[model samples]
Target: MNIAFQDSKDIDKEQVMKLYNDVGWYAYTKDASTLNNALRASLDVISAWDGEELVGLIRVVGDGLTILYIQDILVLNAYQNQGVATQLMEQVMQKYEHVRQKVLLTEEASDVRHFYEKNGFASCDKGSLVAFAKLEG
Candidate 1:
């Protein structure tokens, strides 16, 4: 598979929505315009493409100095076992190599943990760090 990566946020909204939906992230896809706007506003966006297909993407939001929060990293189901997500993350890591803090919040699943761990992320509990979130009602 010939995969190309780009640091771009001007992706097609329909393609972004389709990718999110295919990954079962219906909550993000529910409001296409809002999702598109968020993507546009992100500090960084790295996307993977197999020929013309949008197979994976990783996005960040941060001040580009002290902290960089990985807002999203996803690969299409068919492309999961491949290194698409890893490549996307590598791009993010390389871009922010000097940043002190890199953070992400994701679902609690063994595979999810393993994936992030393999990519150099540590569990908050392991680091004695705490995380909290407030979901809108």
Candidate 2:
């Protein structure tokens, strides 16, 4: 298994589109038309490929200087237990090495939480900054 990382500009849009769609609910999809836009806007994108195939991908969507929000941390089903996600996250974390506050939201998954913890993230309990999202447009 050959593992390599690449940014948005270096990735193939079609492969990323497939990866994003492959992991369905974890990464909800509306339309395929936005894939290009989404990838273009990503602060940093790291993908893990096995030879000529895409096996995993993680995208960071945030302001580069201070806050980095990890968006899509996904690994294809076949590559789940091979440290592909860790490699992708390592690249993302490295890109934000100087960021003071990093945040990300996932679907209350224990495994995901463990992954974040492994990456130096902890549950906020000190009444620091609260997150609020506008549920409706």
Candidate 3:
């Protein structure tokens, strides 16, 4: 499909909401304006486009030097199983190769776990690091 990646937050608001909704990220889509602001404030935002169509997105937030946390990464349901996500991840990893710590949290599914591990991340259980979070849904 000739997916193209843009390393910028210059995406359209409607497209952003749809991309999030396409992957069932209802929480993020609850408020378009708030989400847009979140994207604008991210440490970095990478989007995957297919001929002007938004197919996927990966967003990060962190201090550029010490820690880089991948806040979100999602591909449209129809675009899953292709190399789009892998490429998006590879680009992020490449850009932050020098960052002290890189992190992301995902569902406890086997495939999801494998995806991150395949992209060069180890689980907190496998390392000395432990992660914690408190969220209101």
Candidate 4:
């Protein structure tokens, strides 16, 4: 598979929604405008494409100096387990290699934890750090 990566937020709204919905992230695809706006305001966005197909993406929202929060990362179902997500992450890591803190919050699943761990992320619970979040309903 020939995968190409791009560092930009100029992706098509339709393509972005299709990728999100394909991965079962209905919450994000519910409002196309809101989702597109969020992507436009992101600090950084890395996308993986198989020719013209949007296969994977990873976005961040932060100050880009002291801290960077990974907002979202998704790979299409057929593209999963094929290093697309890994390549996206590698790009993000390289872009923010000098940042002090790189963080993200994801569903508590063994495979999720393993994926992050394998990519050099450690559980805050395993250390003295603590994480908190507030969801809107």
Candidate 5:
């Protein structure tokens, strides 16, 4: 349970792919090159590693001054309830403390909703805000 945190996207390909697959994010793993490039383009990436294993990650992308979109936050199922995600989030919050708007989009399951709410993110419907997306494959 000795997970270490890092402000890095220096993860090797295999580790990154395995983490995404294990989390059922097959869309990201569908194209390794695209995933790698996206990671590099992120505003910031904070991750948790259990030795050589990619246990958890949180990344943000946006204009650094006015808006930040939390692009992803995933923790291996085995490590889900262990505060790894929380630590990664604390890193994002600390690094972006001056930024005013932080946004995230996720499924509407209760556990998922609770997790984000506990992390200080409010649902758009509950606030004076709205979010929209268009996905193509």
Candidate 6:
């Protein structure tokens, strides 16, 4: 497969949002305004396209120089494995490797942990990590 990373500059916000929702990564019925806000706020983005089709996408949202918080790494179910995720991750890492610190949050799964670990992420055992979200009203 042709694995390449491109800035999401040309990506259709609506399409991407819908894809995420379709894959259960986001709730159904999202709006373009919210997605635009996210795209604008992203420090950087890397997308994997397969001949005009967006197969995978990942984003880095942070201050753009020092602290980078990796977010929204997803690959289409049909394209899972085959190094598509790894390729996207490689590009994301290369883009932010110069930062002093890089962080990401993933569900507590052995495979997930291993994936992140292979990418040089470590979890904190002494402290707990928590998440809170308030959907748009």
Note the Cα lDDT for every prediction shown. Answer: 0.93, 0.76, 0.91, 0.94, 0.90, 0.75
Clashes of each: 0, 0, 0, 0, 0, 0
TM-score of each: 0.97, 0.84, 0.96, 0.98, 0.95, 0.82
- Indicate whether candidate 2 or candidate 5 has the larger TM-score: 5
lDDT of 1 at 1: 90
Model 1 residue pairs with clashes: none
Model 5 Cα lDDT, one tens digit per residue, 41-125: 9988888989978898998999978899999999998999888888988889888889999988888899888888899998988
Models ranked on lDDT: 4, 1, 3, 5, 2, 6
Worst 10 residues of 2 by lDDT: 25-34
Model 3 pairs whose backbones collide: none
TM-score of 4: 0.98
Worst 10 residues of 5 by lDDT: 6-15
Using TM-score as the measure, the top candidate is: 4
RMSD of each: 0.8, 2.3, 0.9, 0.6, 1.0, 3.1
Best by lDDT: 4
46-66 per-residue lDDT for model 4 (tens digits) = 999999999999999999999
Residue clash pairs of candidate 5:
none
Give the 10-residue window scoring lowest on summed lDDT in candidate 1.
128-137
Cα lDDT over the full model 4 = 0.94
lDDT of 5 at 63: 92
Model 1 CA lDDT for position 44: 89
Query: Between 4 and 6, whose TM-score is larger?
Result: 4
Clashing pairs in model 4?
Answer: none
CA deviation > 4 Å runs, candidate 2: 26-28, 125-129
Please report the TM-score between candidate 5 and the true structure. Answer: 0.95
lDDT of 3 by residue, 1-137 (tens): 79988999989999998999988889889988899999999999999999989999899999978899999999999999898889999998889889989988888989999999898899998869899988886
Between the candidate structures 1 and 6, which one is better when assessed by TM-score? 1
Q: How displaced is residue 17 in candidate 2, in Å?
A: 2.7
